[model samples]
Target chain A: MLEKSLKGNLGYWAWVLFLLGIIGVGVICYIVQYNYGLGATGMSRDVTWGIYISQFTFLVGVAAGGLMLVLPYYLHHYKDFARITILGEFMAIASVAMCMLFIMADLGQPMRALNVVLHPTPNSMLFYDMIVLSGYLFLNVVCGWVVLHSEYKGIKYPNWVKPFIYISIPWAVSIHTVTAFLYCGLPGRHFWLTAILAPRFLASAFAAGPCLLMVIALIMKRTTKFDIGRVAQDKLVTIIGYAALLNFFFLGCEIFVAYYSTIPGHMHTLDYLYFGLADHATGQVYNNLVPFMLSSVVMGFAGIGLIFVSRYLKSDPLLALSCLLIFVSFWIDKGLGLVLGGFVPNGLEQITEYVPTFVELGITAGVWATGFFIITVLYKIAISVKLENEKTA
Target chain B: MDSSRRKFLKIAGITAVAGIGAPSALNMLMKQEVQASSAGDGHGAQPAAHGGEGGHGAAPVGKRYGMVIDAVKFHENPGMAEKCIEACHSYYNVPDFGNKKDEIKWLWQVPFTNAFPGDESHYKKDDRTHAMQFMVLCNHCDNPPCVRACPTKATFKNADGMVMMDFHRCIGCRFCMAACPYGARSFNWRDPRGSKDGVPFIKKVNPEFPTRMRGVVEKCSFCDLRVKRGLIPLCVEATGDSKAMVFGDLNDPNSEISQVLKARFTIQRKPSLGTMPSVFYII
Candidate 1:
């Protein structure tokens, strides 16, 4: 099965080499950061977490999004999903791997990370996050590999693997919920204190995760003999449509609560993110994040609207465009806007802006390249095996 | 079932229970033994009834140390805050990174509006409150959010209610910095002992204190080492006035800090958050 990844056409090998080149550049940047400390990045005392942490948060949702395929197929016995379930599991494995790498890149002392395990503090949300993330990664790797192996051999998956599949359904939810707790449970951080944070995370994850899967499936359809039937693709678009709608509804609820309640602490971060907050003393306004945040809202609605329209949904290129829109919308919202918004008008009511250095950008690109590299290899194996199985049958 | 099989099952159950329970039971006993020995040493064994009146040798055990600052006195003395800040930084060997982005300070000052953000009053200005600046530092809160958020227990609350950091154990995750509502913690973004572009970050080295390495979070330990040696914190000593900055055991009613609280109207930063700050300001 592993040998299938080794046997690829010139184009496949070229794509793999391109990703490797990006990864190599990233490693060199990381070595510089390792020697110079986090000072090599643009993060400061005010904005303690920059791109690395934001990427980690967004990828957690993508990893948990794999549940959309696993839950419906396994629990409800939906056979329409049978052909593409392995794709979700493999994607999850890649996403979780990226998440762990992002966390490492964010740490000031990457080597001492094991201290969280050696001296585990049950009280910390991070402690629980470590447990759930690693557990989910383990669950996905075992479940994905074993199921794919059994399918390649043309036999029913082992009965023992069933319990793991069942546990994974809830484990996926735990990973994102714990990530939400890491922010929401903190004191004085008004932006993330809302009770709706976890639900919002899941909703965005459901929308963005499946949207990405659909885009990948469409790509596979064009590039290879793997056609994930029109029915399955349409069903996925439906799931993505409702989830994106819920995500926006939750955002509206947050806005309403912040404005109607009229608490200055609650409203100030929102003001800074959207309308720009004015310093009462100096009269200077900080509004760097306004354009990015507004664009996220605009793209979110436009993407969902396009997908829901019957005419556009019937067109493959239009649907792919819509999926890309929603995916990028959530990426900006969760990956860029959320973390930066929380830190602005920092604890002392002073605004300090963050801009990532070239080194930081290089490292971030490296992590993404690594994620795509893993995805390409895994997907190639799965597609090749499926095509072979179809020919024999 | 057969008698041999039943006997084997009974033995296995006992061994499994012992395997799970013996280490924990031993751990509990070991902790008690340490407590007993420390009590015998008289390090923190004295009763609160003794109080600060008994002088340095008779300092009370199981105490909640606190500080009281007279805002009016600070207003009268313009340069006093700078002096105190200087004393603390030098004592701690805190590095000067030469920029705000990487600056480290154990104590500092902020404008009245920034220090007490909840007070949004427009017309309540009086002589004492006019253009006021407050000295800010780690509150050493009774319910410290940093302690609850530290994944490695690197930042912990001591028996005396002081939030202390073990720099060696800190993974530099900065979660503590985010958890702290007061913005009390600072991370060593670069090596404090190292130089940059042929310029040294630390100009003068304090041989008395250990300079921290890069990639660790540090903050005021309430001068716990000095306090342990029966000396007050460096900042309090720098003020040169007993009432200007008072430090004593809050648990002891007869202590000077307790007396100051009883006699004056005091306020704390963000008291509504319920962190129960040990530092109070007399307005």
Candidate 2:
């Protein structure tokens, strides 16, 4: 199975070479930043967090996608998902790996990260997030490798792996929950202070992650001999449909809480994001997020609408388009709106917009390329095993 | 159903429930342990309370130090503002990036509009003449959100109620910056010992206090060092005779800060948020 990744066709080699190219450029940029200091990036006193932290948040949710398959299979004993559970677990491993890399990139002194362990502070939400994320990563590596190895060998999975599989179900939820706690518990950031933040994070993660799983499954169907079957595909569509609705419902709840409460703290971030700040209407200042957030909202609603239409939903192109919309919508929401919303009209009520430098974008692309590369190699192994099983059948 | 089946169900059910409750429960217990350990005078591992040791501490023990500012005095005598800022920045070695976008500040003045926002009727006589600029610093909050947010106990409150920073321990996550209600914390975007054009950025490093590295958060120390030596905060001393800034113990009735708080109409920033900022403005 491991050899399968090495002996891929020319197209696979090309993909691996492409990802390697990104890593090369990113390493050069990282060296410049490491020597010059954080001043090399566009981050300042006001907008401390930038695209790095934003991507970290989004990927944590992406990593949580594994549970969609795990929950259905184990908790409900839904045999349909049993075939694809390994796919979700493998994706979790890649996504979590990316999540860790993004956090390391965001750190000012990445070397000093050991201080979190040397002097632990449990009260800090980050302490908990780090613990859970690392723990979850370990769980997935053990569970995913063992399960996949057993399948490739055409043998029953060892009984010892059961506890890890079960532990990962709840551990998956904890990782995302702790990630939300990182934002929501902050005092001054009105955008993320809501108690519903964890639920909202989980909901969006469910939609985006499984939607990704569906994309992967669809790709495998086309490119390889492995398919998850029509029944599982329909089940995933249903999962995406309901999860998208729940994600939007939770978002609506956030809007209602912010508007009805009339606390300027709560309303400010949303107002700045969705509707352009009227204060900026002096025509002097501009809230650039307005257009991006508006597009996200429109696409989000459209994605949800398309998911409900049975005729359109049944079509592969339509479903893929719908998932693409949902993916882009949440990606922008978490990336630009949620992360930057907390910073604009910053703690001092001063408007300081953050614009990332080219160097920052290069580093971000490198991180994404690394993630995609991991996903490709892992899926290659997964599909080869699936093909072998099919041949045996 | 065999005995093994019933035993498996019992163990699995308990494990599920414990796993769900463990994180929050562990968090609560850790918080209690932390609070219990750092009970009196937030910093220091002196097993006993203040009276047990360090009894001859120059700054009064068991007292939260606070400051009251006469906005009018500083507004009228503008030189006092410069002197005060120079005194604090020089003492702390806070970098002067010479650009507003990259500005690093410890104590600085903000216009009344930005400082005490949403209060339209702040100035009765004239906006320009009456309390135009207000000085702001770390609150040394009663419930310091920054302290809670710091994963390392790098930034902590001392027994004297001054917020302290352990530069070596901070991982530079900037979580404290997000948690603070007032924009008090600043990260070293560039090295404070900056190298400029093949020359040393800092020609003469302040030897009295050690300079910090590029990857840590720093803020107003409330002049804890001077207070330990029984001297007033440098800002208060530098303002000279006019006494633009008054620093004293809030707990002692005889202390100047307490007396000023009782006598004048003073206001702290964002008191409604319950951060209990120790810096107050005397209108």
Candidate 3:
């Protein structure tokens, strides 16, 4: 397996090198941020969390999305997904790696990470998030490695691996749920105060995770000997299509509750996000996020329309385009809208506009580059074995 | 060696029982020790061990500390806020970044409406009819959301009612900032001790207080250091003794704060959130 991946020509190595180059840039930027503190970013006392936390939250959903395939294939015995279960697991691995990196980037003192473990508090939602996330990451690693290792050798995985696979199903839900609890349990941030946050996280995760998998599967199909089967792709698109609908439904539910109740506490965040609310002292209308959030809603619907048209689903390019749109929409909704929207009209009802600095964006790109690199390497190994197996057959 | 299911079950059972049983046993022993220590040294609510080590002195325990602010005094004097602010920052060695984004404040004044946005009018409404500015700091709540949101107990409610922070222990997650309804906490976006670009805002350091490193959350500890030495909080002492700011044990009915609360109409910030804030403002 290693030999196959290592033997790739100029293009493959260039791809690896390209990822490495971005990672190098990221390291330099991180070093600057580390020296100067969080001041290097645009985050302030008003918006304490920014790109790092938002990305961490979204990636938790992507990491949990592996269970989208795992549960259906394992528990429900939906065997169409069997061929691509390993793909979901591998995607989870990459996403989890990035999730950890994002969390580290968000920390004021990265070296003090172990302090969470040292002085654990059961009352803290963040404590639960750290626990579930690391636990899921471990489960994915062991199960994915063992299953792939056995598959490469043309032997069945040890019977011992089944229990971990079973446990991983519910554990997947826990990761995103706990992450939601991190925001949802806060006293004053009304944007995340709603009960819809966890379920909404799951819905968006289901949509974005599988949409990413479809794109990854398309890449595997074009570049490798693996088919992933049209049946598998269709089944996944079907799951993602309904999930996109559910994501929209949850968003609608949140908006309706805020509007109908007419509670300024709830409605103010929505107003700030959708239409810029007026600032009192300054008398200036602040709608910094309106365009981004409105466009996200529009793009999300457009992606759903593309998914259900029946004609577009048959065209791989169209489906891929739809998935890419969905990925962007959900990322914007959760990663961009959630953190900033949660903070605008902050605890003191003060509006401090937010924008990420170049250093912040560079660190973000570096995290994604790292995730893509991990995914590329792992897929190279898996695709090689699949191609070899096909040739032998 | 005990890999058998029955052996595992037996060990697990004992461990479960001990887990439930150990804490009370320890607490009972500690209560007796605390009583013995209190009798010997007049220190109340002192734990035998904190973070696996003994402490130097009296801990605020069994006493629920509270503060009553006379907003009218600050309203009349105006300059009193300046004195109190100066006293707090100098006493705490709080940093000054000269930029609002990076400013670290323990106690400060905002426009009156910002402090009581809900009561005066919507935060977006500009009306000077009920406008009044006053000093605000950490509420040190009975049900502090910051302490609850902290993954590590870096931010915690002391046995006394004060919300306390252990700076060295914080991982700088900033969940506490989101959790506090009062907007009380501040993150050291950069090192508070010195400036990187050579324009230093921290004019002097308080030798008695430890300055914070960049990437940690900090806020008022209700003058825990001064409190340990039996001194009133710096702000309270500077504000006009018991007239401008009252600090006393809420658990004691005879305490000045308790009597103040009994007589005057005092409002705690965001009491609707049920955080049971120790700090109250009198109009």
Candidate 4:
């Protein structure tokens, strides 16, 4: 028993050391980013936002992914969801921490972030995004704490927790919607200037977020004695598959309308992102390849195919690996394509491109590592408490 | 909870819809102003706003520094505006090259016809093929979108009728740059406080209109510093006796701009976009 505990304890410290190495390097990069400026990053006129914004966009979806489990288990009375609800809440807490970090890394002056609250502009969607993201973070924290506390004490949670859970479901949807609004509502951005952007964002979030959870659940089942259970895991995979299909369908509709109508404003933005519009002279290509188009195609096909692998998704380890790969692919496609594609051949028709410098990359790596660190520490405490409670029971 | 609910319902009903409606209404107000400015061309000689009260008490003191550009003369002088652009850029500490994402500017010329889209399109490109006249600087519009979009209130239309930027307060989101139809705004992607080709740029950083740091928006303020010191806008001075660029007030009938407006048929750029640009073009 002592040796077993030591193995677990050693694993924990090793993970901690790994995290520290990443965070330490990341912090150094962040310092450089602070001392210099956003110009240290690969962002430019045609791509005002680059990797940082994309990371933030992906993390918000990941953060909202928790609602998939929370909603079905709490509101809809899926008893099987009880086993994974705590995991969902913890995943949310981790994802939100990542989301906030990604946003900080993107800002030219991260220190002045408090000014968003100090001088609030109700007209700006950014203000709403701030409120919802923070509120959701708070709600998840409280809900997770209360549920975990009840388990520790071997007692039912106070009735107050129910309302918080209910609030979280809609709040999850709101956080992603407001995030979508950050892009969609901007004027002169033809690609993002869409009515269905919010819904499409929601669909992608539902698909990608839950798919990540399914992979984590599978990992838990394999390495540890903890079992998320086959039924619970299978149901989530199916749900994610359906959501991915919807995301693809809506994306198809957007493409169809843009291409068929042939309105220059709408058509040009899509063409720039997907196929090189007008000329190769006008397009943004790094390493002689259009990064967004290739990544989007690869991810799109893999995601759709993996989701349709019903039996494989339910039982096979390969299916779980496919989900993880597709989830990452979808994230890359969404981040690069959605934000940077909007600004190429900027309003003035100036075609200068952007690439993040070393400082920018360092800051980005630091932000990502910091996110993982938050998740690891949070999860360690949560799992320890759950294990302790299980021993007592 | 009931009271909060009631308040939420009312605000959500009114302000949310109003929030969406406000930009459109603002756009219309701008359109009307542009239309009024265009029609004023038929009226009078000129009354300089600064010419009242002997440059003293209330001196009717404030300058409504508007510009009336002659498009036909632009064909006469190929690069006249470049002098004015150089003068303003020099004073403002705007960098010449580097990160296209964040670069500052005081004035740069845009084609006079493409710059002014609202007028009757009687003049074709081939008719005036030699050279295109340019719209020089900020219009200092009655309803300025830059000020509205600025989160820090860093960009505000001053009491003196200049659309000014407070560099110290700018957080550099560049929404103002994106929102401006004429693409009049610029950002400092890097510290522009350096020397290029052994010529020192940003020698004297003005405190009132402070020199900007990296990643903050800056734009033409109609030479706010010059106007504050009782000088005709640097651009107007550069145009010098060819008197190609006219500067004065629309508010006062005695202003040079007003006199020129009454004498010449002038046009503003993209009046359809409804930015109510104060700068005008005369053919």
Candidate 5:
């Protein structure tokens, strides 16, 4: 039995080594970016923000997804979520770690990020975002630890912990909404200059965040002997389907308001993002790549269709595939769509194209790997804790 | 519960400290009072100004610096704008070349029609070769939005009407960049101060308005450093008394900027924005 437990541990070690090798290469590229500056990235005057910011935006939703799972389980008393809630908390910790890394990569003077805490600007949405993100990170970590310990002992949580669990429910929604406010509150950007952007971010997060959680559940089921109950998995899928539906509806409303009003400023952003505008005269695009217009339409419909299909929802592989597609679709919509759309057609109203550099791509990869590495370590520790509890029982 | 109690006590102690400290600080800093309706009212019109120089306290004598550009003349002599812009950029240590993502610009000319869209235009040209007239510098508005948006109060309007950015205190959130209607703000995406070596006679920088590092937002200060030293703006000096770039007290009737505006048919950029821009131009 001991040999079985220890058997081929070298494989796990080698897998970690491979991850580290990729991380090492990413680190070398990141150093090059630091030496040369953000100019090493795809960012340009017309497109001042790029992949780093978009990735940060995308991850905030993913991190929030963990909370959405936990809140309904603990607060709403959904005992079906008991098995998977630890996974949710673990996912949150990883996703938040990634969100922070991506943000730090985008800063011009990465060292000065510490100054944000020392000299907090209360008026700026960024200040509030820092507070909420750090707070949620701490809350999930502590709560997850406590709950996992309780489960090991086969004991119920003390009455006091429930209140804290309840607080985290809404607090999770606040994280992505505030991030949306960071972009949408800015006055001049015609694409982001809307009040509905925050709600849309929350809707998309719910849609994409839970879908990712479902896939993570499936991955664990495939690799590990630990059996995640099918009922629990089905409930998670249903939640994701409903969230995606809301996300699609909200997106449709945004398009409706833009096209129906006939305001050139409002409509221009939609025309560029969804429908390709005339070549280069006024639009942010030069050759009209039509990345957003087509990607959003195809993936968005596919996501909605999969959610509505009973067989796709029931099948683990189809469910995982649909979740992966929806996640990618939203990532493109939020990351590429929101950021690129804001900048296209420079402030001077001139059209200039932006392309990302290799160094920028490398740093972004490093950030993503770091986030994954963090999750892997945390989940390992959590599983160890669970196993230790089972042994005592 | 323990943390909340600690937090509560901390807040109460701070309030107590503030209550005890405020009166004495106020007395030492501002003892004299004048019959003014609000703080925004003209302090110059106050009765007992203060102890420093006559009744008016140690309040600074501020000049509401302005520019009255003749766009018609600039249309002919494009070289005038180029010279003025170069002077401002060199004085401020703006970087010359970088990716558009990281470009730092203190003062550069933008086309007038682009600068102020929806204005009444008598001249229109379809010729592909013809360029529109350009306005060269910061508007330095009366109610400057940059001043309001700055989190650290780093960008502030001086008693004398110039809007200045205190580089030392700036944390560089770039909110001021978003707030400016004219798109006047620029962020230092790379080390802008390193570019200062090429400019002659601008060797040292003041810590109060230090040479900015990467990632701080900067804009035209209307040459506040020149004003503090009692010199006219570098741009105005470059104009050689042609009154091409006018600078003076907008408040004082006798000031050059006021005299020119009253005399000529002057127009401010995007007056509909209601920023009350100090800079004006004569077509």
Candidate 6:
């Protein structure tokens, strides 16, 4: 089964090599960052967290998004999803791996990361985040491997795998919820203090995660004999469509609460993100994220609208385009906008804009490449097993 | 085959439980031992005797330390805040990164509005009040968000009500930085002891205090080292006038800080957030 990844065409090897090249670049950049400290990145005292944290946050949702498929297929016995559940689990394994890497990259002392476990403070949300994420990663690895191995052996999956699959359903929700608690529980961070933050994270994650899987499924359909049946793909799109709507609705609720309350504390971060927050004394407006945030809102609606339309959903190219749009939209909202927006008009009401350095971008790209590499190999193996099973039958 | 699998599961379960349970049990034991030793040293036993007397020997424990800043007095005495900041930085060997981005500050000043953002009063009639700068530092809150956020107890609230940081244990996640409402903590973005163009970041080294390494969050430990040596914080010492900056036990009602709070109307920054800041400003 492991040898399945080793057997690939020229194109497959080329793609693998491309991912490896990006990873190599990332390793070099990380080495420089390791020596120079986080000072090598553009993050400052004001924006203590930047690209690394934002990516970690976004990827957590992508990882948890696997729950959408797992829950429906496993719990409801949705037969249409049976073919693609392995894909969701494998993607989750890869996404969780990236989330962990992003967290490590963000740490100022990467080596001391084990301290979180050694001297675990249950009170800290990060402590729980570490537990859930690693636990989810472990669950996905065990469940995916056991099920796939059993499938390769042409037998029913072991009964022991049932309880693990059942636990993973709720565990998925906990990972994102704990990640949200990391921000929402903090005092004086007006942007993330809202009660709906966890729900918002879940909604965006559901939308973005499945949308990404849909796009990947479409790509696999073109590239390989693996077709995650049209019915399953359409159902996934329906899930993504509703989740995107809910995500936007939550965003609207946040905006309404911020504006209707007329509290400067609640409204100031939003103002800075959408409409530049003006310094009353200096008459200087900080609106670095205004363009990105506004575009996110536009892309989110446009993407959701395209997917919801029956005509576009029927068209593969258009559906793929819509998914890419929604995925990018959520990426901006969660990956770029949310974290940066929270920090702007910082605790002292002074705005310091964050722009990631080339080194930061290189390292981020490296992490993404690593995730792709993992999924590429995992998917290749899954597809090979499926094809082999189909021929045998 | 079934028996072998069940046996493997049994061994794995024991290993897993031991792996997680051992450290936690040891941590609890270590905490109790520390408490027992401190209690034996009389630091935790007799709280009433060590109240504002600036007790000799080990710093007074089982006390809530607090600071009261006389804002009006600070305003009257120009350059007082600057001197205090200088004293704190020099004493602690806090590096000058030569730029605000990487700057490390234990104590600093911000404009009146910035210091007390909750005060939303518009159109200040007096230019003096408008232009006033308030000294700000770690609040060392009774409900410290940083302590609650630190995954490793690297930053913990001492029995004396001072928030202390163990630089060695800090994983540099910056969760404490995001958690701190006051923006009190600063991450060592670069090695504090390192040099640039043949010039050391810390011009004068303070042998008494350990300079921190790169990638650790640090802030005012309320001069924990100085306090342990039975001396007041450097900022309070720099002020020279006892009325300008008061430091004493909040638990002892007879203490100067407690007396100041009783006599004057003092405000803590972002009191609405309910951090219960130990530092108070007399407006």
Flag clash pairs in model 6. none
> How does chain A of every candidate compare to the true chain A by TM-score?
0.98, 0.96, 0.97, 0.92, 0.91, 0.99
What is the RMSD of candidate 6? 3.8
Candidate 5: residue A98 Cα off by (Å): 1.7
lDDT of 5 by residue, B189-242 (tens): 555555444652224453444466665667788878778798887777777656
What TM-score would chain B receive for each of the candidates shown? 0.79, 0.77, 0.76, 0.69, 0.71, 0.84
iRMS of each prediction in angstroms? 2.4, 3.9, 3.5, 6.7, 5.3, 1.1
Question: Which residue ranges in model 6 land beyond 4 Å of their true spot?
Answer: A310-313, B1-21, B24-26, B29-61, B122-125
State the lDDT of candidate 2 residue by residue for A210-294, as single tens digits: 8888877777777677778778878887787787789889889989988998877788788888886645213445478888999
DockQ of each: 0.48, 0.38, 0.47, 0.17, 0.22, 0.68
lDDT by residue (tens digit), candidate 6, A123-193: 89998998899999989998999899899999999999999999999999999999999999989999999
> lDDT for model 2, on a 0 to 1 scale?
0.81
Interface RMSD for model 6 amounts to 1.1
Residue B283 error, candidate 2, Å: 1.9
Per-prediction CA RMSD (Å): 5.9, 6.3, 5.8, 9.5, 7.2, 3.8
Range of the 10 consecutive residues with the lowest summed lDDT in candidate 2 chain A: A277-286
C-alpha lDDT values of all predictions? 0.88, 0.81, 0.85, 0.69, 0.69, 0.90
Model 6, range B1-283, lDDT digits (tens) per residue? 3999979998998899689768867887897798788889885654533332232222344578889988878899999999999999998899998997898898998887788775857227567767777899999887788988999999987658788999999999999999999999999998999999999999999998899999999999898777777899999999996478999888788988888889898888998887778899986
Judge the docking of candidate 3 as incorrect, acceptable, medium or high.
Answer: acceptable
- Worst 10-residue lDDT window, candidate 5 chain A: A1-10
Candidate 1, residue B174: how far the Cα is off, in Å: 0.4
Give the candidates in order of DockQ, highest first. Answer: 6, 1, 3, 2, 5, 4
- Between which residue pairs do clashes occur in model 3? none
Tens digits of lDDT, candidate 3, A287-349: 989999999998899998887663344788888888888999999999899978899898788
Span of ten consecutive residues with least summed lDDT in model 1 chain B: B49-58
